[model samples]
Target: MAIMAGPGDPVLAETAAERIRELMDGGFVVDADGQHAPVHADDLAVISPHVEQASAIAARLADVPGVLIGTANHMHGLEREAVVVIHPLVGYREAPACATGLGRLCVALSRHRAYATVIVDADADLVLAHAQREAPRDARLATQRHVLAALLALG
Candidate 1:
């Protein structure tokens, strides 16, 4: 599922942290290695494309014991029962190549076993639209822009 944190919203990482806290309230169960069980702190992960963003989310989640938080690259081979991904374009007016890469987005979204929540800025599509004005020259970015657009549309 996706949630939009608009330009006027709280810091993106804070918004994600709030959602994570709420998810931990109770009664949530997830499949772990094919067995169903109540979700634990250790079963949750918070992922972002940037290290600083991950670190900021980690600071806010310090009170929530055992949750793994890290950049998408840092989490490449890991999986969790649930994941909250802070969309890299959340605070940007234009898309950054580093964040718009298809691989990074895929890694961030695919690391979940049962549930996934992506927190994106409401204006992300606009940002990508602005970036698209010059995207055709770069085929890879053009492709990524299409994928990002589809993800936003899914929300």
Candidate 2:
């Protein structure tokens, strides 16, 4: 997908942008500010927190559908366009960010009527069958909030 890693970080943004542009047959040529987008992903830092920037990139990136992924070393806010932020632990002390875990993530994407399911991928299907079971909505969300609180405490 097309990308513009937030401000100050240009490396990742440039590489991701270049790859996406190549995949897009070179249609991606503009940045959030209407300038020529970077040529590689390593040219990124933290993408601007402006929705316009996101919209610009999303427009080009949407060519690849069903691709739900994002990355962060230590996420501090709602990472736009990401259904999941892979942090060792998420922290939300002042706000109830993970009061709904994946549900909240779905809600943030405007899809709230969701079911909470945790899946474990491995070679043994039978062993992971039960491991992939769904959790009660409220309970799962509570667990997420609790985990976030714990992370905040540890930090």
Candidate 3:
């Protein structure tokens, strides 16, 4: 599943990434090619809407036992057990300026086939609202919402 963390806060993104690493037992791997390659238990992947953020996260996780970081573009068409998306709301409001970026974020969230997605952000409602507006008639978005609801309900 694809998880989102944001309002474009770097601190939150970093913190969320760290927490996820802990939950995964410090196991995460980068799909490098987004080929849906096999990942071990210790493998962890971080996806970000911005290259700078992704790179920063990668650098911060450099010493982690088992973690890989990259932008959503790098993991296109790939599937993993879990994916953490940081600062997904970066350009959510500025549609024109971030049209490509927003599209990338959506593609990253939708294309990546994960069992669970952990979205970390202060304003999840805003994120959802923007997403609904962006893709009101998209079936994929509907499915994603359903799955996310189910996951939340399970907890």
Candidate 4:
């Protein structure tokens, strides 16, 4: 699976790592190395646009047992069954270009065949709007409310 931490939100990545570790402990197998085996440190990939953020997340997840840290470039040609994208919303008035770029990145990242793509961001509404606009017809939208409700139920 792939997890994309925000440009400056290392905590989000750390939390995700914790959740992933918990899931792993509960028998969630990720990228079984083509043998349906258990996940190893090399199976999970953490991606971010900023090298520093990516590196930080990598370091935080270093002891997770089998997770790997990498830049967004690593996603090319690879298939991830699950992905978590942590995007920070840039106000359009502050920097339209940057906002557009991040939105494009989010859309591109969501195009993969991952069974689940969890995007955590304060501006999730904007991100989801952009993603839905560019998503394929088969894609379905899952709002944060729905996700939170599910998590609550599980709890």
> lDDT at 59 for candidate 3?
65
lDDT of 2 by residue, 1-155 (tens): 11123221333333333444453353223556877642332222222222343344444456555332232212234232212111211111122332234543333333111211111112223222222343334454454445444433543
Off by over 4 Å in 3: 1-8, 26-42, 90-103, 110-114, 127-155
Candidates 1 and 3: which is better by lDDT? 1
Which residues of candidate 4, in runs, are more than 4 Å off?
1-6, 30-37, 88-99, 102-114, 124-155
Across 1-155, the per-residue lDDT of candidate 3 in tens digits comes to 23343334467456656756664664444465755444553445667767777767766676664654666778776655666655354434332334234456565565444444545333434455567688798654554445445545654
Model 2, residue 144: displacement in angstroms? Answer: 11
lDDT of 4 at 69: 50
User: Candidate 4's residue-wise lDDT over 21-71, tens digit each?
Assistant: 654565345343654555444445554555565577767776675554544
Q: Model 2 off-target regions past 4 Å? A: 1-33, 43-134, 139-155
Clashes of 2: 23
Q: Whole-model lDDT, candidate 4? A: 0.47
Residue 106 error for model 4, in Å?
6.2
lDDT of 1 by residue, 1-155 (tens): 23343332347778778878877875367443666566689889999877777778888999988999998899989998889988767777767777678788889989998888888766677777778777657765677667667777787
- As a whole number from 0 to 100, the lDDT of residue 96 in candidate 1 is 76
Each model's lDDT comes to 0.77, 0.31, 0.55, 0.47
Cα lDDT over the full model 1:
0.77
Which candidate leads in lDDT? 1
Model 1, stretches more than 4 Å misplaced? 1-10, 30-36
Ranking by TM-score: 1, 3, 4, 2
